[model samples]
Target: MTLPTTEDRDPQSIGLSAKPDEEVLAHILQRQIVALEAARDAMPQIAGAAAALHAAAASGGKIGYAGAGSAGLTALTDCLELPGTFGFPADRMRILYAGGAKNLMTLAGVHEDDSEAGFKDFQESGLGSRDVLIAVSASGTTPYTLSAVQAANDAGTETIGIANNADTPLLREATHAVLLKTPAEVIAGSTRLGAASAQKAALNMMSTLVALRLGHAVRGHMVNLVADNEKLRLRAQRILQDLTGCTPDDAAIALQNAGGRVKTAALMLLKNLDVDTADRTLALHDGNLRPFL
Candidate 1:
């Protein structure tokens, strides 16, 4: 059997260990650029996946992520940030990392081979037809990730597979396949280098597009962001100011009255609506500020 390109050694790195420090670092940086290009190549598939994810979220459905090792960490980073970044509900996101949190410190390679664990985790995640799952694997054949995608398919849940290899089971089975054809890793099978970069870039695009479609992002600002910190509170203020041309005091008052929700505050100021009416009107428009603006 032919090894996947991710496992194939790059001829350019034949003497990488003996190279000068600058040359070695330059090679690594160039490979990262290539990985990002791979993500750019998958824009169409990423857009489709984002559309599906947006549909699921709009319909009050959950989003799940499954992976192992480096891929799992990438997915976890994206999953955990959704709520704070876009005001997506934390309860609506599920993570199915192989070996769960107990093994996160080590991320044992053995866990990636545990197909049963993957299937069990997916079954217990409560993801159904209304939900969507994104599974990532460099080789596109990791047992744990593949099993989770298969289980999701069986449950009639939409799935987006992000893989570095071509024609693998994950890609063939997933509802939307995002193939990130990253170059072979400089360290051969160590996909954490280039493959992880491509996966992260692809996921970033997908999630950002979903946020834009949901109207959580407007004019490049994260309008629906959960301003739970001082920095974010300041950002919320700025967004209100930029969008409404309101004074700092007026923006602060609107933010307070609207419970720090940028969209609600914007509507309250822009439409001359009271706080209660603004909140209700924003909800009536499905939290989409574009309609009100």
Candidate 2:
């Protein structure tokens, strides 16, 4: 096995020649474009990871995310969005920051290099066969992330590694690996500049796709989105109105009785059916509105 690198890692600590104000501005703009382009190019990786995660979720498996440094925060953000946006089941999603629980919301850079700690974290948690573990590391060599991947693989869990560098050890160790090829940061080795942004974009796509597979979406609309805010409530009313051929006012009225259930509200008003009957009919149709039509 190739040994891990103990080379100087901090980009800021590296020999980056500072330029004049105009040159710095130009470099910043260039890096921004590169970062977005890198994100676009990394779509397939996210798609593959999402497909794997969605299948595991369907099979009653828990989804876990692990990462180090800024990538860890990205993993946490991605996992958190799944629940609030798609109503994902609680307790089935997990995110592990390398510094453990206390490191969240704080920058604890040293923890990124600790593989033993990472392995212990996984062992302490109840990882099992019906679980998928995803590790995010821009360099594809964070000792912490690699450790978690190895532990998860040892546990017979599906493992996905997300990294900016190609041909890294974590890639070979993981069940699946996504290589996001972004240009080196304008600020040198600072992956938080470009790599974190790309990782976040990929994760956003992955989680959203998984939600789609779980029936939280229909076509392009978020049919299962919770109407917990005024914006979403308006959206729900509009959806019911459009589907049932009713006035917005009428749809809003039906929505109240349907407990803000857009599908039930539309069917109740348009089919001239009660809430119970509408709900039962939707269930009978397997929740596909087109079939009901």
Candidate 3:
């Protein structure tokens, strides 16, 4: 039987270990570039998925991510950061990893084959017609990931499948398929390299587009980011200053008055409104700041 492209041995792997350190590093970097290019090639699919997610979020729905192994880690990373990065609520996100938290540290390969666990986990996530689920698998054949997508489909949730290989079950089953056609791994079947890179890049693009569509991002600024930390608070102030052309002190005061909401603070400064009015106006526009800006 012919191996999938993701499992094929790359010619570049020949003599890789025997090569000079610089040559080995260069080959790895080159393959990463190839993987990123594959992600770029899937931009249309990613955008479609992002549109679905944005609609879901707008309607007060959840976004769920499912995967296994390195792909699962990538999905988890993206899921965990949405709240802080775009002010998306943590409770509105779900993660359906194969083994739950039991194998998170080890990521045992056995869990990837547990289709029942995948289906059960997704079912228990409570995501339905109003929600979106994104599942990632390097080979597009991991049983766990595929099952989660299947469960999502059965639950009437929109599903997006991200995978490295072409024409596999996960891709076929999903509502939207993002094929990141990364080249055969230099390390031969070790998807942690190119495949994981492509998945991460594709997910990053998809989520960023969703944020933009939701009006959480403005002029490349994460205006709706949760200012929970010192660094993020400083960033919120900077965003307020840059967008509203307000002094640093004014930005600080506005942020305080707006409860550390960068978008509301900007609106307050730009429209010369009180905090309550700015908040109400933002709500009137569905939390979008573009019209006020």
TM-score of each: 0.97, 0.81, 0.97
List model 3 lDDT by residue over 69-95, tens digit each: 999999999999898898888999999
Can you write out model 2's per-residue Cα lDDT over 1-293, one digit (the tens) per residue? 53222222434324335557676676667666677676678677678878889888877788889998778888888878776576666688887779877887687889998989889988876777888998988888889989989999999988988888878988889887787777667655677777788788778778777766666665566666557689989998877766667898898888888887766776788788898998899887645455443
Model 3 stretches astray by more than 4 angstroms:
none
Q: What is the C-alpha RMSD of each candidate to the true structure, in Å?
A: 1.2, 4.2, 1.2
When sorted by lDDT, best at the front, the candidate numbers are 1, 3, 2
**Judged by lDDT, which candidate is best?**
1
What TM-score number comes out for model 1?
Answer: 0.97
* Residue 85 miss distance in model 1 (angstroms): 0.9
Give the TM-score comparing model 2 with the true structure, all chains together: 0.81
Better of 1 and 2 by TM-score: 1
lDDT of 3: 0.90
Kindly list the per-residue Cα lDDT of model 1 for residues 1-293, writing each as its tens digit. 76789999988888988989999999999988987899888889988999999999999999999999999999999999899998889999999999999999998999999999999999999999999999999889999999999999999999999999999999999999999999889899999899999899888898898888889999889999857678988999999999999999999889988888889899989989998898889888899998765
